[model samples]
Target: MGDIERALQTFHSMRVSAIMPPIFSMPIVAEDSPIVDVLKLLKTRHHVWVVNNKDEMRLEGLIRYMDVMNVLLPPEHTKARLGNISSLFKSILGGAEKASDVMERNVLVIEEDATVLDALKKMKRYKVQILAIVDENGRLVGEVSLRMLIDEFLRLMKLGGAQWTQHGSSSRSESH
Candidate 1:
């Protein structure tokens, strides 16, 4: 490919390997683990992966901090009528539930070798904020979010001297 094509190609197909940290390093829990465990983990972590195998961490799905809140908090009307009392009850009761009961299944995932564009496309299609990264074995290896992707993109654009921003635009208009 030409120099321009190669440079542009980086924008379209930057591999996740360049950005993702090792996945196995993240927190994981058994699917049947009590929700209380997840809540405790989330105190210091954004989310935890749920695994099916107790002996081995085989990812089944993921439980986000927001998902736990969704379970503990009542709907808008319910909240208005029941006030904080009902939600307080749920906070105590919800802890008894298992991870599988709350974790989001069929989570969108991208292979480690896939491009950032591929990951972005899947996230958009699934309407999800985060995506699990998997290996050829389809085992959870890492996680990526739209925030990370965009930040990395912006960093690259700035480094490339593309001058696509307000300053660049003003300069272009002045030159014309």
Candidate 2:
């Protein structure tokens, strides 16, 4: 079969487990963690998983970078000092001052056994960059990201495109 056809077959068969990032290293924080502290943790990352507490590690929700961006500083204040950031959000956020206060409770997820097609649908429906992967028991095991999926897809396409460009036709067989 041709490279593009084979690529489609491969993509359709890809499971979440095939591309999900390892779960052990994901950044996590307590639901009650202070907003300032969470912001500090998220400064270099786009998201953080919030657990019920430091001990239990029960998944509560996710604190997206966007939430921090919305609560803490206006877009124009990207260069604002840390000291001023807290006060800026403090008044606007009212008495809810913790991660749980702003976390996205309805985090979209896909079963670990789900296919790439399943993940793409969920991502599109939720308009999220990543989809949390869960086991049958609904425990977070890992995560699948849009970047990972797209990168893999592009890698396959590039292979096909390069071959076609050099050969002036597909490197695939006649029956393809």
Candidate with top TM-score is 2
Tell me the spans in candidate 1 whose CA falls farther than 4 Å from its real position: 1-8, 53-56, 73-96, 167-176
lDDT of 2 at 153: 79
lDDT for each residue of candidate 2 in 46-161, tens digit (9 for 90 to 100): 88887787655567788777766557544344444766443344322444578887677778878889999889888888788887887776667778888889888767767565
- For candidate 1, the TM-score is 0.69
lDDT (10s digit) by residue, model 1, range 30-51: 8888878888889998888887
Q: How much is the lDDT of residue 16 in candidate 2?
A: 81
* For every candidate, C-alpha RMSD to the true structure in Å: 6.4, 6.8
Error of 2 at 160 (Å): 8.0
- In model 1, what is the error at residue 129, expressed in angstroms? 1.8
Worst 10 residues of 1 by lDDT: 167-176
lDDT, residue 102, model 2: 65
